[model samples]
Target: MDTQNSAGTLYIVATPVGNLEDITFRAVKVLKQVDLIAAEDTRHSKKLLSHYDIKTKLVSCHEHNEANKTHQIIAHLKNGLDIALISDAGTPSISDPGYKLVTAVAREMLSIIPIPGCSAAIAGLSVSGLPTDSFLFLGFLPKKQQKQKQALEAITNQSATLIFYESPRRIKALIDNMRTILGDRKACLAREITKLHEEYIRGNLSDILKALEEKEVIKGECSLFVQGQLEQKTIDEEQLEKIIISRLATTELGTSDLARQISKEFKVSKKQVYDTILKSNQIDS
Candidate 1:
């Protein structure tokens, strides 16, 4: 309903993740009405558009070319040509391309609309059976082994449910890493969601790893929903101080970073950790 004066609106459309019928009626109408559709993959999106008989012109706007395409998209918007942005599946900019274009459009004081429909993360979370009252949607983890561990260690004490997206090829490796870092926590692995072979493996991280090992080859993208730290043990001040001092001696992490990591790991106040760190620094000085 809200439209830019004379400029065209940039609609962030959400397409089906797998099953075509999963799309909403509103999304279909917008795709049909838009002057042009900017897709992450034109060839891949053509199948969906063809299924619904949407004949709107398609253009490439994927990660590789998104930078060059952003300026072009803005020029079209300035010329009053409404555009719809979509990805190969699910919503654009959700671990997909479109963030840069959206940001550029907003800065130009142009109208940016959202034609919300299906999101893989939300779809996976809805049926994950994990506590959804509070959640942390970490779209994907770092690829490097050490960086991956660092990322996992940073959130080791998060209380909210954790949601992550991973490729089928790397799903098993990710689970192995998680098991090593987060313990054998309860989890749900949603694979090939909304498709014929859609499967949900519910159990501990170890169970999921075993399941992956049994399979000949994993297929499709995967969403891993893991339970957060459900218990926090009290840390004695003296013991915590010694632990912090030892960590400082071994790691190059600064005061703030060390305090955060220690507080999360120990379930203590960051201020407490900071005070201990400061006192230790004074003593060493």
Candidate 2:
């Protein structure tokens, strides 16, 4: 390979999430032909490689090592050796480390190709039986319960279906936050997708949580899809203003809680309701 290898390309390949044979033929061909494969976990990837009889060399490119490995991988591509970036499962950059490397490579004016195949997010949405025209893919929420609730609250009023990825260990906790903050909106949980014991449980968030708790143990990553907020109806400004004034006079709810309660009653966003409440308070003062 020429040191000035200007024609080098970076292939973003997609591996299977659970089933080995789910990989695309083009992906397999690219992996075998690339000069090198930068995998999230080379050890974990070896099983797939061995199953497919791929002889290409693989190097570690996970979250811990990606920052250091980026330069080396870029150097090889610059030296005219084409390379492929793959994750332990699914596409390279979806909630993975391929973003940094891909961004760096794009800056250098090298070609980057995508060999798309399977993605757990898309797989879950396809069969979720929810509206899919518009969606928000939240890879994972924060670990803290408060932070997770705040995150959900921020997007509670969006009319787009919400999708999330979770591990078996924290799936219950995540559902708890969703139910608390987003209410028991219709949802579906797809577990162990594409595997032998794969299952999809459909219901409101609370029902799904209750069912999962009954199982002695759970495993595999979970894909969750929630129906979007109800369509906004025609709101009456004067009517809302009167309700706010009456509620303040008649009830002892704090401003934030009042906003939450009123927002639900009127099918408006919490932020909008809160902002109006602030303005009302300022005007009274």
Candidate 3:
């Protein structure tokens, strides 16, 4: 509890991602006492505050308005008004927009307190059943397929569990790209975290993809946790063929050109794709 004496303080509060019960006692008290709340989404914050019967003034402080709002928030703080900043879900600035405001406030010698609580990223990793000692948090992959694949390829060699947030619409495509870039590594797809419909699909990329296909439609926010590289069998012909097909769908390249491209992307052999393409063509014919 770092509250400035005679000056207003900035409280960086963490709200529940799914389960409301996950909120901490100190967080609730600070929210109630704060003169103003700078939230990523005021309407969303209102619901949380109403749930606890705590009515406090809330102002929008998201990525879109953070730059403009930071000055206003600081002005209020200088006038001795204590403010609390929170995100729509989880801790502010984890994957949200509180960093700028925090930095601005600190530069002015104002106290900033962090009221930590539930975070879906940590929640998923804690029970992911994967290696957790060293992990990297990749907030979200690029929307473009090629860029996303390139990003995944860059981190494929890291010996740490990789955690990422993904939307349901792109989850399948992401998993497909991951399978291409990272091979059939052990992974878990945790969704509807902390809620009643919470589910964790654990296995290699292929198995998880099959499980997702069986579902009518995947729902909720998703956190994808992937195990790092280890001593495993090399990527087989079938996997190479799948990557070739995926790239072909998204890019215009001949079988020979595609084979070379996939080989370079996954650090595999062009012969592997050439042979797999030959086998695939035989099956199709």
Winning candidate number (lDDT): 1
* Cα lDDT of model 3 by residue, 167-272, tens digit: 9999998998777667677999999998899999999887898899999998999999999876433566677777666665654446775665566556687798
**Stronger candidate by lDDT (1 vs 2):** 1
Tell me how far the alpha carbon of residue 98 in candidate 3 is from the true structure, in angstroms, after superposition: 1.4
TM-scores of the candidates are: 0.82, 0.83, 0.83
Q: What is candidate 1's lDDT per residue for 40-60, written digit by digit as tens?
A: 999999999999999999999
Clashing pairs in 1: none
- The 10 consecutive residues of candidate 1 with the worst lDDT sum are 251-260
Q: Candidate 3: deviation at residue 108, Å?
A: 2.9
Select the stronger candidate by lDDT from 2 and 3: 2
As a whole number from 0 to 100, the lDDT of residue 58 in candidate 2 is 85
